[model samples]
Every structure is written in C-alpha cells, then in structure tokens.
Target: MVPDAILQEDGPLRPNLVTVAHAQYRVRAGALSVVTETVALTKALGRVLAQDVTATRDQPPFKASAMDGYAVRSQDLARRVNPATLKLVGESQAGRAFTGRVSRGQAVRIFTGAAVPAGCDAVVVQENTLAGEGTVTILSDGLKLTRRHVRPTGQDFNCGDVLLKSGERLDPWRLSLVAAAGLDRVTVARRPVIAVLSTGDELVAPGEIPSGDQIFESASHAVMALIKQWGGKPVSLGVGKDTKKSLLRALKTADAELIVTIGGASVGDHDLVKPALAKLGLELSFDGIKVRPGKPTAFGNLKDGRRVLSLPGNPASAFVMAQVLLKAWLETSLGMPPRQDYAHATTTAAIGANGPREAFLRGTCSLSSDGRMQVTPFADQDSSLITVFSRTDALIHLPSGSEAKSPGDLVDILPLDRL
Candidate 1:
C-alpha cells in the first residue's frame, strides 16, 4: 500500500527513517575511496590517521629526576651515627648530564627532568636539605625515605609502542602525544575535498544589503565549518542563482569527491538542482526522506562518479542534517566507520505525538539534580530558525508514531558536535 504521506508530487516515494539513515552512506559504498597521505605533524591536526602511530623512542630514555634536589645513594642517607650529609660533586641540569658518578657520602645536584647520575638510587628534595660550603645535610624532618623521586626509563612509553591506531582523528591532545613520540612527520588520511553549493535566487551573501526580499545565505557557511571539523577540505562554490545555467555552472566547477547542494531540491517550480544536474547525468540513490526539516535531502552520484548530497536551504535543517549525516559520510571517507550517534536520555518536559516523519528536535542537555542526563526541547522547531540551533547542544529524536513523552521519560538523543 502506498503511504499517502510519501505521495509527494514530483519526487520519488520518500524512504522510511531507517533507510534514510543507513542507505545514504555512498562515501563508503564503493564509489568514493579513502586516500592516504603523509603530512607534517604541524599540519596534521584534524586529519585522520591512515596508519598506526608508534613511539619512535623510549620516553625518559634514561633514569630521570622527578624533583630538583640532590641525587644520592640510599645508603648515604641512612647514616645512623653521623648526620645525613654528603659531599656535593657536580650538577646535572636538563639535557646536560653530569659526567662523574655518585659514591657513598657523595651527591649530585639534579634538577627536574635531568638524568639521574649513576650509582644514585634516591633523590632528597632541596626542601629537605641544608646547603653548606661544598656539602649538603639532609634535615631530620621525620619523613619517609622510600620515595625515590625518579622517573624510570620508558616510564611513559617504550619504543615502537602503538600510541594511536588507524582512523583516529588528530586533535590537539593527540597531536601533542604524536609530537612527543620523536616524530617529525606522520601518515594520515588525505582530507576529502567536499564542495558546498548554495542554490537560490532570493539569497545574498552576508555583509551585502538585502536589496528587496533577499535574505543572507547562512547554511553553506555553517556546512563548510562542519566539513573542516569532520576532516574534509571544504571548497565553497558560492551561490548558484535559481536557474539551470547557474546551478550547472556551479556544479561543473566542483573539483571534489563530494558535492553538497543546499536548497532547490524539492518539487517546487524554483527547485531546479535535480534538473540542472540531470543534464550532466545525475544518478539518484535515495531522493527524499521521512524526516522533519530535512525531507528535501537527497543523495546520489554523477556520471563522473562524484557523489552529491543535496540538503535543504534552511540553516537549521541543513545544520542538523549535517550533524546527522555529513559527519558520518566524511568519517567514512577518512577510513572510519560511521558511529552510532544516538543515545537515550531523559526528557525534562512533555512532548506531543510525532507526525508521520521521524523528527529530530533541537534540545539542550545537562545533568539533572541526581546527575541523570536530561534534555529540554526548544519551544520552536522551525526549520529556518538558526537561533534555536545555536543554543542546541543535542537533538531529541522521536520516531514516527511515537507516543507523547511525559517528563522524565527516556528518549533518544543525538549530541551535536560542538567543535
């Protein structure tokens, strides 16, 4: 039986919610292939690793001091009859090791991170020692003498230890780890070049005066930011006017593995993205989905094998779908599997029954009084409301035919990527 909900005028039967989420993974669908490249560690941030990152050398290659004091043999500090004192020999500063060795009744001045001198098994912190002419005295502060205060060789990691596995995105902390691994370069997945095209006649770029009834195009800017955040190189194709020629021209200039089209994807008279690309052999995969604010979203590939993900023009719709879909697609192209981005959380307010389409409601999440994860859906869910999305930290997901949810009811949530 044909569902009356999906019997739209000019598009194919809208796919159900499950198919909408799973079937559109064309980046990993034997069309777009993941590419690998070696990049400098400085330029590797936000790029995915194509190979496992191994530590090139042992951290703290030698026994290192964890405190700034004197390095002495433990027997030297255990003097019972005589005061705990030793003759100061030499100083061991960081990156400058002392040549002479420590013997009984002898100590070497060592700073933090300096290599511990040989024949020394313990460190007496400067706070516990009183400096004299050429010798030092360990004060009887009534403290335990068990603390060696020495970082053993390979304390952090050994040479050839796998620190990062394949498909891990390099963030600042991860980059610092790689930098500390004695590496100047690393092999990472080449960022997929994704082109963003905004199509409309009544839209103008920000900073321009909206002459008559035009509004500023905002979705493409947010999409480009998302592309880079998800490890893809974003190429902006600017705005394509509401004409076949305009869209085709913009589409032709997309030298990218994926083209993300915003707006002009519905059955309306001005919706010409499909028609414009049809002239260039646009193959359709899944045309429309049964989801609010993103029903016009579609996925396909062109004759040249470049994949296209058409999104709605509205900023909220585009941004939400980008979080849900584009994030997965880009990760897959970077050799990572699409993550399960949904989890269950308690709703703080009552929610009415959902319509036929599965809805993703913008919401804010926080720990409640008892530390349970709780979410509150925004009052207005208009697809054009960018302000609502700006404050949204999570998306409360309600499947089609879902019953009204009371306060404290558990619901599915998709957390937005704040980065």
Candidate 2:
C-alpha cells in the first residue's frame, strides 16, 4: 500500500527528524551527480576524470637507449679479447636517430633517450667504454650480455592501454602521465554549482555597518570557501530576511544542483526556512539531525530536482555541519568514494557524558613532547563563538550516550584542514 505521505504531490511538508547517519545516507543519493565534459589538459588539474583514458601512442614509441653510451651487438662484445674495439659510425641523439644500421665490429654513439639503431642489441655505458676519433672500445662485459640497457618500445605503456580510470582525481603526477600518453585534452566531471544562502533579518553583508542588534553575515562566505575547496563552484545568494515572503523571493534566484542555506532552520518562531521552502514545492527528506552544534540541520529536494541543505544559524555550528555533512554530500555528488580523515588522539582533559545527540567538540590538536598526538577541547563550546572555532584544529567526536572519559583516553578527531 502506498503511504499517504508518498501520494502527496510535493511529498511531506513537515521535516522528518532523523539520526545523523540516516540523514547523510539520504542526502548522498542524487545531489550533484557526475556530469562529464571535455577539458584541455592545461585546465584539467584537480578535475575528476569522467572516462577511462587510454594511451593514444606507445610510450618511448621505439627501442631507445637508457644511457649515454655506445650501442653495439651482443655477439660483437661476446667473450673475446679483454677490450673489444669497434668502429664508431655515427651519433644517435634524442629526437635524432642514426640512419645507418650497425654491422659487426661497428657501434653508434647513442645518448640517453636516443633510439637504438638496428643491428645493435646492447648499450655499453660511456664509463664502460673508451671513445676516440671514429673508434670505440668496450671495457666491461662483466655481466649477462643481452639487450640489457635498451628500453623496448611500449616499455612504460602500450598504445590503447587504459592509463587512467574514471572517477580518479587529476593530480600533477597523473596529469603528466596523461600528457605522456599523447593526449592534449581529457574528459572530466563538471564541477557542481553550489548555491550558498544565509537567512535572517539580523544579518548584514560583511564590511557593512551593523546596528546594535545586527551582525555581519558570515556563514555563507565560509560555506562558499568550503565548497570551492571540495571541488564545487559556489555562488552566494546573500542573506534572506526572516520572513516567508522574503525567503521565497530570495530562493527563486538559487539555480544550482545543491543549495545550502545557513540559519533559520530550527523550530523557533522566526525560523521560517521550512515553511518558506515547503510553500515553494520542496519535498522534505529529513531535518533536525541528532548532532551537537548543528541539531537544526535539514535536507530536502526542490521541485526542480535541486537539493537543499539548511544549516544552523550560529557560525561554529554552520562550520561543523558543513564539514561533517556537506562534505560527504559533495563527495557523493562528485561520484567519489567516501573518505574519512579521522585520527585517534589522547584527550588532555576529562569530558562529560554525551546526551542522546552525538557531539563534535572543537579542540586543539598538537603533538606532545613524546611525539604523540594530544587533543585538548576548549572549555566554552558555545556554537556562536567563531573565535573558538578558528583556534581549534580538529573536532573531537563523541558518540551518543558515551560515558565520561578521563585524560589520556583515546578519542577520534576529524582534522579541520581535511574538511
């Protein structure tokens, strides 16, 4: 039987309260899924690959010399005299190969990366040979005598071989590899456009004079920076006044794959984000995650298939929610696997038992005198304290209903920079 909730045209108007994990799972589904586009190699850095890249041409394309030496036949340097002398025909430098074939008792002066001329199967290093006018002497036949110093054609990779798989981030090393594969461009996933919105009548743009009750709007700026760092293009929609009509008007300009609004998401009388979005045909997935500093966090979808994330109004809360929740959603939307950067560290002080909601406390992470990582959480954990948030290098995560822990207890920490 179809639930009445599902039968509704715009789905549930009320936001469902859920655990943080469940909220994350629902938010990771279709928001900002991978979109592919061709991009020049010069602009491909930091972009995720959308297709399996194959080598267009063989690396090294031909048999090349691996050392600055004389190219000779194995048979000519076989067990003969102590120093076998051969006639030096011509030189083979990189980008210029010796045209003539090397006959018996004849050697070519080949530099590193130079294609080995025909009839030569070995490269005697320059240090292992004596070179004079039109003649060369092989002094070392000490080891096995095959084509040991020649880099065969297609040595690193062969033509048509898959060099990079889809969904791989392009770093400097991978970009170099792509260039070596004779490709001038690559197909990569399009960066998702993220729209950041800050809501509240008390908020004003930064650098503007704030009255006694007004504060500078900040949450959207931080969120935008985070989105850019996480490989998404962010557009700030500025502050939406704390009124249903004003919010609805501001939201009309938010045309993006994911829209993140800061503040006015809770159940307060002035918290009008839910009603505003609900009236605009938003299908509520979940709201009110069970987490500290961000319990009012909400996630849903607009009528046009755009995802909406409503964060807490406080600066610290907004930052933490962005890291813990928005980061995962962005990764999923980009088609990348989830990566947790949590590390274990010993606490330097005692922490009280957690309530029903999970807690993420801002803390300073530093190396102790003994070279072990130590975490010390701040005494004041107020969500509005941006100064405390700035000083902290990591978040100390305590599970729901955890017992009071003393100093030296191991705890999980999520590094601030990783977010």
- Candidate 1, pairs of clashing residues: none
Instruction: Look at candidate 2 and give me any clashing residue pairs.
Output: none
Model 2, residue 81: C-alpha shift (Å): 7.7
TM-score of each: 0.89, 0.84
Question: Model 1 Cα displacement at 164 (Å)?
Answer: 1.6
Q: How does residue 315 of candidate 2 score in lDDT?
A: 94
lDDT by residue for model 1 (68-91), tens: 998888876664544587899999
Distance from true location, Cα of 362 in model 2, Å: 3.6
Task: List the candidate 1 regions with Cα displacement exceeding 4 Å.
Answer: 1-18, 24-27, 78-83, 370-372
Candidate 2 off by > 4 Å: 1-16, 78-81, 140-149, 340-353, 363-380, 391-393, 403-410, 415-419
- Model 2, span 65-98: residue lDDT tens: 9989988888987767688888999999999999
TM-score of 2: 0.84
Q: Compare the candidates by lDDT and give the number of the best one.
A: 2
